[model samples]
Target: MDVLAVEVLRIPMAVDLAAIVIGALTGGLLAAREGFAVSGVLLLAVSGGLGGGLIRDVLLDVPVVALTNPVYLPTVGITAMVTFFFSGWLSRTTGLLVGLDALTLGFFTVIGAQKAQLAGLPVTSVVFIGVATAVGGAVIRDVLLAQRADIVQPGPYNAVAALIGASLLAVLAGPLELPLLPVAAVVIALTAGLRLVSVLRGWSAPVAID
Candidate 1:
């Protein structure tokens, strides 16, 4: 591969790993809350860590890197172990889980959009792909835990935040001629910031009245 292609691939991997670590931490905490065993915690961690990327790759018709590469598994595994052992500390660290989860949402959103752009998908499709990647893991996690998916739930504008961020990045990168790195930074910041504000301010979509 050429230098630019290699760089693109390398950058995604960094964002993917960051998302994985944060997702694993959140999954570990959830498993602990449910009184899950070590094995269960690890399983949940892997699901949350790699699930969204798997969905994104599948949608893009690309090889799932988590399956093909050794690094992803080990990185998530170590993160899960640390999270499992330090559950108490993590729990005590107020806002840590929420912050990490929001950041992960942003990372996945950007990853999905960039991949779709590289695939030469249309702008609308890129936005949808970004939203899908952002929410796929949470949907899986919710199913496993027997809880409502965040995207469907009535609070905090989880997927909406991702959509806004992803759409913003798509516009900036596609039309405004911004570099991918700066585009990604703005997307992550906006996505995470929106989520944080929503949570703190109790923002939610309007409910249908009977």
Candidate 2:
């Protein structure tokens, strides 16, 4: 039987949307800690939630999911408000924010890769879009917060993890013709796990040599 004889591994669109909400929650928490007002919180949250996918859609020449999906806007908006109000409790949890951030990184990387592939993009473009989408929101968030983007800073393996995940997608789902859901799950686990370990252990990606 052909690959189509079995059901493919596409994750439901609704489940994938949790990634945007998680990103927005992180942004809202950051805004709260920064003493940003309601407007500022909303701005950062929206940027973090939708920025990466916006870039992906624009580059792919597709409709922006944030604008097109009714649930996207409202869900992210509510996530920001919740994070803004309950930031104290959220922060008190052990590594909760960082975990969520890493999780979103994994989700974005795989999602971007899958979307690009569905668009008939090249492997290189798929990886690029995947990595860009994973880190784009954090770049925007840090810029708005007046700090250097963490991905650019000599910090943990944020982009590196995304790179690994995207490349894995290129290999496993693209050429190998494996099930996308399992491939996506593996990508998310490795990407997020690598990120979490790097953060917890203070493992820095190699910096530019002098």
TM-scores of the candidates are: 0.90, 0.91
Query: Model 1, 22-95: lDDT tens per residue?
Result: 88778877887788999988988888888887888898888887798789889889988987888888888757
**lDDT agreement with native, every candidate:** 0.83, 0.85
Candidate that would win on lDDT: 2
Report lDDT (Cα) of residue 153, candidate 1: 64
Best candidate according to TM-score = 2
What lDDT score goes with residue 206 in model 2?
Answer: 92
Off by over 4 Å in 1: 1-7, 10-15, 208-210
Determine which window of 10 residues in candidate 1 has minimal summed lDDT.
Answer: 1-10
lDDT of 2 by residue, 145-175 (tens): 8888888878899999999899999888888
Q: In model 2, where is the ten-residue run with the lowest total lDDT? A: 1-10
Cα displacement (Å) at residue 106, model 1: 1.3
